[model samples]
Target: MIFTIARKEFRSLFAAPSTWWMLALMQFLFAWFFFVRIDDYLQVQAQLTQLANAPGSTIAVASPLYSALALMLMLLIPLFTMRLIAEERRNRTWVLLLTAPVSVTHIVLGKFLGLMLLLVLIVAGSAIMLVTLLLGTHADLGLMLANILGVLLLSASYAALGLYFSALSKQPVIAAIGALGMSFGLWLLELSASDNRSFLRAISPNAHFQNLNMGLVNSADLIYFMLFTATLLWLTIRQLNDERRSS
Candidate 1:
């Protein structure tokens, strides 16, 4: 049943022309950045070779791409997630979902999974470009996989937070703005808190993501992502249940 809802949401997103336009825009931006990075790497290749411990192609090229991709997810996921519940509520379709046989948990999970599929598509688009690195240079497979994992987890956290905001507001624009504000706020928190041991930096998703982006996958970072995602998902479920009771 969760998958059924997820599939429906996935198809619905693809049905909209705006979705295609957004995807195209993202890919275009990624391609531009990717080529620019490659060009820069080539320009500095000679200098890097002279260094005792020079970074590889993966570090020089793919790391920055993934970092940019993470920033892109922060901006784009909210746009899609805003419509998940807020639009349905605005259209008077949320009542249908509320009265449906499926539990609130299922609905929330389904919506989140649907968004995950879109996130995966976006990440895969970037991955396709990263794969081309193998042709010209030796790519760091381990680092690449770590970055991929970091991206997926980071996007999932974004989606979960956005989902909660979508449930909180009937206006899709408000939901989008709320999600964006919170995401940016957390990023600011990471920046302002300079101490690595500070609680604020410890709670910021960007900090944890940076750890994985550097290919240092610690258990602490993994746990942070899990707790962050699970807490928001739980809150979303509770919000929907409260709405169901109120209605």
Candidate 2:
């Protein structure tokens, strides 16, 4: 049943013209940043070569590209997730979904999985661009894998957070704005900390992602993302259950 809902949600996304436009925009932005990174690397290649512990093309180019991609997706995800549940509520379909035979958990998980499938497409586009680096220079496969993992977790966090807001509001625009505000607020929290060891910095997704972007895959960061996503999903489920009981 979850798979059925997931497939339906995934297909519905493609049925909309906005999905196509978003995909195109994502690629265009990625390509522009990629070329800029290459140009910057080329200009500094000579100076880097003179240093004994110079960073390679992978660190110099690929790392920053993934970091930029992460930030870009951080902004774009709220737009994508805005309609997940909010649209249903606005269209008066929320009652039908709640009355369906499927459990609230399945509905929420299905929607999350659907969003994740779209995220895979976005990540794959960037991965292809990253792989091209291997043709001209030696790339760090380990670092690349770490970066991929980091971005996936980060993107999942964004989806989960947006999903909760989507469930909270009937209007898609309001959901988008609320999600964006919270996402940006968390980012600001990370930036406002006076020290790296501050509790505020520790709680922000950006700090953990930075560790992974640098290829340091700590257990704590992995745990943070999992807990963060699970908490949001759980809240979404509870919200739907309450709505069901009331209706």
Candidate 3:
């Protein structure tokens, strides 16, 4: 049943013309950044070769692309997730689910998974460009894999957070703004916090994502992403359960 809902939601997103437009725009932006990175890398290749411990092609090119993708995800995931529950409620479709036998947990998980599958498509598109680099130069497969894992986990966290905000309001615009504001604010906090041990920065997902971006795989960072994503998902489930009871 959860998978069914997920499949339906995934198909509905692609069915919308807006989704295609947004995807087109994102692809253009990603390709522009990717080509620019490659050009810059080529321009500096001579100088980098002279250094005792120069950064590899993966670090010089792929890493920055992933960094940009990370920022793009922060912006795009909220937009994608905004309609998850908010649109359903706005169109009076959510009421059907409320009256159905499906558990709140299933609904939230299904919605999140559906959106995540969409994100996977986006990540795969980005990976194609990254892999193309292998045709010209040797690529760091381990670092690339780590970055991929980091991106997937980061995007999932964004989706889960956005899902909670979507569950909070019936208006999609309000949901998008609220989710983006919270996600962006946390990202800003990661930059503004001076103390390394400050609780605010420590709690931000961007801080943990930076560690993964460095190709350092820590269990703690993995745990942080899991806990952050799970906490929001749990809150979303509670919100739905409350709504079901109230209705």
Candidate 4:
């Protein structure tokens, strides 16, 4: 049942022409960034090589590319997730879903999984672009794997946050705006903190994302992402359950 709902959401997203346009824009943006990174690396190759502990092409290129995509995901995910529940409510389909045989957890998790499939595609595209470096230079596979894990967790967090906001309103625009505001604010919080020990920074997913981005797999960061995503998903489930009971 969850898989059925997931497929339905996935198809619905792709059925919209805007999704295609958004993907095309993403490809263009990624291509441009990929080339820019390669160019910069080439320009400073001499200086980089002379340094005993200089970063390789993988760190110079792939790391920053992943970081850029991570930033882009912060914006893209809200738009993608805005319609998950808000659209259904706006179209008067929310009651039908609420009355369905499946539990609220199935509906919410299905939608979350559907959105994640799309995000996984985006991550794959970025990975392919990053892997192109292997044709000309040695790349750090470990760092690349860590980056992939980081971005997946980060994108999932964005999706979970947006999903919760989507459950709060019938207006997709409001949902999108609320999700984006919260996401961008948390991101800025990470940037605002001067020390790693600050509680404000601790609340932001981006702070933990940075540790993974550096290829440092700390158990605390893993726990943070898991707990963060689980909390949002649980909240989304509770919201739907309340709606079901009230209806």
The whole-model lDDT of each prediction reads: 0.95, 0.93, 0.92, 0.93
lDDT over C-alpha atoms for residue 241 of model 1:
99
- Per-residue error for 110 in candidate 1, Å, reads 0.5
Ranking by lDDT: 1, 4, 2, 3
Per residue, candidate 1 scores C-alpha lDDT tens digits across 1-247 of: 8999999899888898989999999999999999999999999999999999999999999999999999988999999999899999999999999998899999999999998998998998899899999999999999999999999999999999999999999999999999999999998889999799899999899999999999999999999999999999999999999999998
Q: Mind sharing the TM-score for model 2?
A: 0.98
* Candidate 4 residue pairs that clash: none
Give the range where candidate 2 is weakest over 10 consecutive residues by summed lDDT.
Answer: 93-102
RMSD of 3: 0.9
lDDT of 2: 0.93
State in Å the error of residue 106, model 4. Answer: 0.4
Model 4 worst lDDT window (10 residues): 125-134
Candidate with maximal lDDT: 1
Error of 2 at 158 (Å): 0.5
lDDT of prediction 3: 0.92
Question: What lDDT score goes with residue 170 in model 3?
Answer: 90
Mark the regions of model 1 whose C-alpha exceeds 4 Å error after superposition. Answer: none
Q: Considering only N, C-alpha and C atoms within 3 Å, which residue pairs clash in candidate 1?
A: none
